[model samples]
Target: MKKVLTACLLFVSSLTFAQQTVQRSAKLPNSDITETFSVLRSDKKIKQGEYTATAGNNTTLAQGTYLNGERAGIWSFYNISGKLIQTYNYTDNQLTFADSTDTKGLQYVMAGVKTDDDVTVPVKIGGSYSFRPTFLSKVLTQAINKDFGPVANATFIHTFSLNSKGEVTNHQVKVCINGQNKLYQVDDSELDHDLTRFAPAMVNNNPIPCKVITTNTVAMSNGNLPDYANSTYLGQ
Candidate 1:
């Protein structure tokens, strides 16, 4: 009788321990419900239920019911001022919203459009120009010939600017002599003369003003004669 009683007691104790282990692993629904009420407290993925996230008294940050971590239903987002910035319906990582017509608006903004007042117009200042690197090199070569002796070979740089109307307003030339040396600076007036006379640049279907820059060099042969070589140009 003593041995049987001891065996029964041992069986009951083992069953109780097993039940407690299962209960510890299982989570009660009410515990999750209690945690979901606080903001910034629960970062775990939410399931299908209604929840409100508020920024302040009047400003509601976001409010909606999420289904399996995906916004199955409607989701509304507000700015700090409580203004409705965007209302989105997200399903499987896809969003549906109104089409945007800000393409021209963006361009206008980039063109330096002022927004001080409601009424504004795109200022039509003047045209502009950008020189290709190849063109710049050619200009430099030419300038070197005029300033220095006949350049056998030369490397030049041209810098020009564009106005609001995309017109070339200024041009500057820097020339490297003897194929290597400190660059010689030339005035925009000189470059303007050459560009307007020989290589005029146009902007907005009109011929706008521009400047040119160049570097020159001369190659001496055994016979003491200079050999003219081609150079490169740069574009802005």
Candidate 2:
């Protein structure tokens, strides 16, 4: 068994009751969240440590640290497809930053996002519960594999623009393999699936246009990385 000593922690908490580090996983009470956190070696109670919660498919939902059983430090919250939505700084007692900038990275990319008063993004009719299993898994995985040839494992970044009418256009995809990225402007026929539906972005009772971005990590395994389930993703 692996062990880590909370040397000063035990001295302060229980006069030498050092805590043992062990791998622990459980579902949060009254919630669909399953999480992993550190617990006392002797008492088995949650101790100060890193905390992570994930969706049923093992997609990360929230990530942060816990101090004396309370959430501490920076906490990042994400939507179902793994796009970062917001972050809070617990240690400084600040709400920190909402995802206001265009999500940019080598493996993933999205463009042209501005934070204006009350300008909100579009939403799919059934949220992620309906979106992921229905569109993402089937559309991206099956479509990409069939169209691009049987890729055993890879990462995908899909970005598309939506108008006030909720009509999504300019769909583009970037396939990351071995750190090399190939960008593809996909046609509806090439993808072999419809781009799903969206409700429409809103601003002060009126609809607005916005961009939809998502990242998916696909690894063929027993379960670690589900299709599009990321570290997780930089969705917007």
Candidate 3:
């Protein structure tokens, strides 16, 4: 009997803590949010010593490391059900790693966004209700302003999709230069990450997947955009 009990104890010890969400406040004014600091033990791997953000329904919205109350390292954003929507690499509070051609990577401004079918789209839910564009923009602006600094000189265009469970997927970004919509180089990692901080989407009083796209401009002192003449073709 002792041997059997000892074996069970060892098995339990191998498992990590249960996933949990906690409410936390930012020292900076008007930045309160729910944080999932749990060290979750997934079947494939164990995620320890990282912080995750969640909405009111306990769906993971963002995941990253925090140093002295500031976001650090590669942060991942998810839809309402924890699907990876976007990833942002940061260092010393500055957004980095803005160059990629992956579907989830940044793109030079191009002009072909396909339209969705006539199905009922998911609604952006906040707390016990849906979110208005103005409020959503306000929340996104706070995170962008804090992490990526000002963006008065460039436009960030981001697109993503959510599954029927309101989980985000198929994340992408694009950049525009010179105030023209035809900008190049994708540099909207911070914008995408911040946008994931909102509540999940819902349809017919139930969570449903949907697509989201947002555009925002920042005012920096630069007027010349990066010239990637050898850039990969968009269709590639």
Candidate 4:
């Protein structure tokens, strides 16, 4: 009985050791191993064809696809340091090809343009609720007014061009009074004289030229004639 018990114990120990060794030597399947790339500030994990990157603080820095080990597809970046970015698609271990001067890039360029360039005007297109021009215009107007102040009652016409990428360029102003049906060229000072403000129109999520009109009405608490306020301009 003692010999049999000793043999049984030895067999159990050997089986345990063999199982442990097998487990240690086994290689995890590639499917079980997720591909990941990490930086000091951010870390990205890739699984199958999906990729997601997060900053140190748990902020989503980028999300896209990984082909093999290379970045592929469209990637969006926010801020210079790549604090926020997104990647899409996977092709040849790199992001898919995007036109260098796409609409989004052109919008950034147009926003920085010092000189004017003649381009096409962007027409309003129907889309989802968020893409409606009227909604955007109202939102922009309200934002401008909240930032600035109420503007005077006058018709100010601004002509601007948009490049093929839907970027605004070549901004000019034309003003018209109630009495004058014809449009008149106005200088920047005159245009700026009134509390007028402009937010560039957007086309396909890009800035473009769109006409904006601002009007303000001034009222006095005490009854006063309109002409009395303009004493200096009475003779002129």
Models 1 onward score TM values of 0.23, 0.38, 0.30, 0.19
lDDT string, candidate 3, 80-162, tens digits: 45555455554533323321212233122212223542233332322111111222233344434444443445566666555
Q: Compared with the true structure, what per-residue lDDT tens digits does model 2 show for residues 164-194? A: 7666666677877656677766544322121
Number of the top-ranking candidate, with TM-score as the measure: 2
* Ordered list by lDDT, greatest first: 2, 3, 1, 4
Q: Give the whole-model CA lDDT for all candidates, comma-separated.
A: 0.35, 0.55, 0.41, 0.31
- For 126-145, candidate 4 gives per-residue lDDT tens digits of 10110111111323333333
- Clash counts for all predictions: 28, 4, 10, 11
What lDDT does candidate 4 reach at residue 217? 30
Number of clashing residue pairs, candidate 1:
28
For model 3 the TM-score comes to 0.30
Per-residue lDDT of model 1, residues 1-236, tens digit only? 99999999999986664343311112111111111221121433234345444432344545555444444565554443455544445443223331232111211212322345332222111011111112333344455555666444444454444443333455454555565544544233432221222222333434343333333232334322222222222211
Q: Which stretches in model 4 have alpha-carbon errors above 4 Å?
A: 1-152, 180-236
